[model samples]
Target: MIQLIASDMDGTLLDADKKLPPQFPALLEELYRRDITLAIASGRSRTALLSLFGDLAEELIFICDNGACVMQPHDAPIFHNLPDQTIRDVLDLCDTMPDTIPVLCGFHHIYFPENADQAVENEIRRFYLDYHKVPYSALYQTKEPILKIALCNMHGTAAYTAPMIQERFGSQYEIPVSGDYWMDLMCKGITKGAAVQDLQKQLGITPAETMTFGDYENDISMMECAEYSYAMANAPEHVQKYAKHIAPANTENGVVRTICEVLGIHMDSLRKSV
Candidate 1:
């Protein structure tokens, strides 16, 4: 019996347009009725996730900032922050990299360099709801800890910025290519898998009782943490290799579809109930 379900937002749960399927609300209600917890695991910030889900957001668990922060509904969030000196070093390094803008993710707001262009700001606003353009030095002075440092490369992080970042900081930090255009840097050992394991222990659930879905490399850790892990059919072959199952593409409402199929919830009944 699956007691928990965690799914990545961007390429797994949300469609290419970043919208949730129409049936998602109904599906969520059904899951809640059955007492199954659905956790949104994403590199997105908490505020961003909440905006996307609206009032429904309060009902789900969140593993935000690629698991640098974790929270259950109505509970104080837990954070894993890089050392202050490390954050300064990362910011300084990002300054020298062309086409890559570093975003300092804090508990309340994400910070961008004051000189970032409008195009990049527009793209970033899609994922981060609350943001400020400030001098990089201001990031180190924030009252809240910096949860993660994300490098945004519109041209594509994997082929460009990611390798450079990996080569420079891979051994010292937990850096993951979170999306086609984004790579995240965090404290070592902070991963979606670790967050999932924490939740499992808290809820008295085991890997066999947990199910997860993801579509990228950053999701691999959590993929390994579930007995019923699924990779979206749209995922790369390398990512698929880590999962136990293959879900339909996100465009096809894969997360909800797979949940219904594996848990025996008829879509017909779900639609009728809606």
Candidate 2:
């Protein structure tokens, strides 16, 4: 029996407009009634997730910042910060790359260099709720720990930026292409998969009892941690290769639809009159 269900946000749970499914509340309630835990895992921050989940925030498990931080409602959060020197290393690397906007993710807020393009700030704010514009060098001085360092390229990630970062820092950091335009870095062992493993131990559930859905490279780790892993039909070729099954597109409410199927809820039968 599935005890835990986890899904990525951007390309798996949320639609292209970054909106959640309309029937999500009802679906979540049903899952809770069945004693199943819902884990929302994403590269987004806890604050951003709370804003997105609203009333449901306290009821779900959050694996945020690409698993650099994990928080369960009413409990202290577990966090992993990139070493100060590592943060500096990423900043230095960003400096050498033109048109690359670096975002220093912290538990409290996301930070951007004062010189960041206005467009970049707009993009980051779309998913990150608490954020600031500060001198990049000052990041090393902040007392708050750093979660992950992200670089955004308006054109695309897979072409140039992702490769450059991987070649330079892949050995020391976990560099994952988060979306079409962003690549994020954290300490080598920090990943959504690792976070899921931690959560499994804490909840006393095994991989067979977990179900996961994802649509991007960053989500591959979490997909690996669940036996019921599903790749969105709209996911990239690489992403689809890692998952165990395929679901409908995110726009079609694929994640929820799959959950309903797993729980034996027939949509067609429900719509029939008595």
Candidate 3:
């Protein structure tokens, strides 16, 4: 019997239009009726996730900034793995590399560059537009510290500069590429898997009682952490390798279908009986 369900926001739970499925909220309601916990784990910032969720915010635990921040809905943050010196160094690097923008993500707020272009705006929209403007210097001066630093390099140069940057910053700073053009730098212990473990412990749930859904490199640890792991059919092969199950694509209501199937909800209208 599953006690918790943790899912990735972007490619697994959200559909092609980047919207949650029409019927999933009801499905989640059903799960909650059964007294199960629901969590949204993503590389997105906590504020962004909350804004997108809007009214539904109260029913979930948010594991944001790729597991760097974790908290209950509409509540003060309970967890953060912020790195002060690393955020400073990453911001300095972005200054040197003018073509790029370093997005500082934390449980408190999202820091943006002075100005951004269409590509950058599109990137921002993808996370539901949850950022505020702050001076680079003031951003680094934060007493709150930083959970993750996202380097937005639409030119796809982060891969090239990333290795050198990691070498310079050493182990405390780690750069992980999620999209083709974007790279995220996080502290050593801050990862999706680590966050899942934290949630599992808090809820008194174990791997056998947890289920997760995801479709990206950042979702890899989540896919590995849960006993009942599922990789969206739309996921890359590398990410799929982490899951024991493969559901249909996001456009096909995979989450709802898979959960309905697992719970034996029998939604014959939504699927062709085999």
Candidate 4:
């Protein structure tokens, strides 16, 4: 039986517009009735996730900031903070890199440049809720635990910023290209795959009992943690190579649809309950 399901948010669970489907809550209810645990794993912060999930937030597991932080239902989070010196070094790198925007992600807030371009601010708002616009030094000095150091390059992460960061910090950190525009530097051993393993250990679920869906480079590590892995139809060519199967596009509610089909949930019968 599939006891656990973990999915990446952007380009996998959320639609093209970056919004959750209207049917999510109802689907969550059905999954709960079946005793299936759902985990939402994303490079987003927990506070941002809470806003997106609303009242359902407490009921779901969140692998936030690309697994640097994890919060399970009714329990305290398992969180890892970047070393202070590492944070400073990354900050220095971002400050010197042209066209790169660095953001300090924490358990409670995200800190970025107050003087950042308007477009950057708009993009940041799409994923963060309790974000603050602060000077670089101010952000570096924050007291909150630092989950990850995020860098954005509108030109493309894999082709530009990620490679450089990897060359410089690869031995010390896992610099995963989060999306076309984002790269996240986490502690060397930290990854979504590791987070999933931890969850499996906690829930006593084997790899065979877990299913996961994702569509990006960071999601590749997550795919390795599950025996039943699915890459979205819309995923990039490189990303498609990792999964055991392929699901329809996220706009079609692929994750939810696949869950329903696998669990023998009849949508027509579920309409009233939904």
Question: What lDDT does candidate 3 reach at residue 273?
Answer: 28
Residue-level lDDT of model 1, residues 1-274, one tens digit each, is 9999999999899998999977788899988999999999999988898889998987899999999999888788899877888888877788788789999898888889888888888889878978989876776676677899989989899988988888889998889888888899999999998999999999999999999999999999999999999999999999999999999999998998999999898898777766
Candidates in order have lDDT scores of 0.90, 0.87, 0.77, 0.88
Give the alpha carbon lDDT tens digit for every residue of 129-181 in model 2: 78888887776677788888888888787786887789989898899999988
If both were scored by TM-score, which would come out higher, candidate 1 or candidate 2? Answer: 1
> Which ranges in model 2 have alpha carbons more than 4 Å from their true place?
266-274
Q: How far is 144's C-alpha from truth in model 4 (Å)?
A: 1.5
lDDT string for model 4 (1-274, tens) is 9999999999999998998876788888988989999999999998988888999997899999999999987888889999999988888888888778988898888899887888878888888888889987797788988999888887787887877798889988988888888889999888888899998998899999999999998999989988889999999988889999899999998988887888898766556665
| lDDT tens readout by residue for model 3, 69-164 | 787856677555555766776778778876677887756667776576778767766773556766666766666566787878777744655665
For candidate 3, the C-alpha RMSD (Å) to the true structure equals: 3.4
Q: List the residue pairs that clash in candidate 4.
A: none
Query: So what's the TM-score on candidate 3?
Result: 0.87
Give candidate 3 misplaced runs (Cα > 4 Å).
73-75, 128-130, 133-144, 268-274
How far does residue 161 in candidate 3 sit from its true spot (Å)?
4.6
